[model samples]
Target: FTVVNRNVVFMKELVNKTINLAKLNSDKIPFNIETISLTDEIKNSVVNNQVLFEENDIVVENHVIDEIYVEADHILLQELLNNLITNAVKYSLEEGGSISIDAVQKTGSSDIIVSISDTGIGMESSQIKQAFNEFYKADDSRHNLDSSGLGLNICKRIVEKHGGKIWVESPGKNQGSTFYFTLKKVKKEPLKQKETSISSI
Candidate 1:
């Protein structure tokens, strides 16, 4: 039963990845942009993946400030976070490690750089360059068949769709890695405009 269930899950993920890739290629994915609290989004992602964290005995620290705001599609942003966090968990140390999320806004730029840092099996320079390529698996021997090798590619497309950029840096093998992405930062949450009805004017 367990094996069958696992296979079923894998198949579902494969289908989802394929569909997402096709949509991304065709530019069909619709994004509903709105003001978002960066910190709250990170917290929500952590909560959504609580089970994964507990299972792996991994510690996740979110240090993003509450004042950070951005315009994004909430669902897509969550998906981006989930992919990065899951990748971190997948490459984490055998005895468990930590993943920290933080954000910094440059002095005069409207962009905020958000980073997901993990104390996991890090990547080399070459691997980092190809990490986002579709079906380009890093260290195949270390990865299970469950990996679709499309997560990072999807993440890249998502970031680009949001007019942002994504990249990764590592301190060599078994050291650690940090994935950074830029988002247009808003000074504050935009005030919601109220809807009004004019009856039979």
Candidate 2:
């Protein structure tokens, strides 16, 4: 019964990914871009996946500062994070490792770079190049049956849709990997000044 339940869940996820990929290719996916707090968004994503983290005995650290804001589709951004986090968990060490998320805005740049790093089964130079390609699995033996191989591809599409770029970097096999993506930054609005009317008095 447990095996059957797992298969059913996998099938549902596979179907969802297929539909989302088709929609993305056709440019039919809707995006509602708005100013969002990067730190808060990451926190929300982590909290949403609390069960998965606990089950895998993995530790996640979110280091994104609260002051950084970005223009993005909230739902799509959450999905992107979820995909990356799940991918990290899949390749994590047998004894469990750590995943860290951080964001930085370079001086004079309008984009904020967000990185998700993991102490997992890292990839090689060749694997990094094709990691975002649809159905491109780095290592079949390392991946579970539930992986549809479309998560990173979907992530790439989502980042590009937001006028950003995404890439992965790793030292080597068994070292670790880090996924980085950029998003347009939004400045906070200045406080309005109150008017002082004393002439009437």
Clashing pairs in 1: none
- Model 1 TM-score is 0.89
> lDDT (CA) for every model shown?
0.82, 0.82
lDDT of 2 at 34: 70
Q: lDDT by residue for model 1 over 84-121, one digit each (tens)? A: 98888888877788999999986898999999999988
Writing each residue's lDDT as its tens digit, candidate 2 over 1-201 gives 478897898889889998877766764445567777788888888998888788778899999756877877777788898999889988887778889999988679898999999998899999999999998878652334368789999999889877799999999998999999999887775323233211110
Clashes within 3 Å, all models in order: 0, 0
Candidate 2: stretches off by over 4 Å: 140-145, 190-201
For model 2 the local lDDT of residue 184 reads: 86
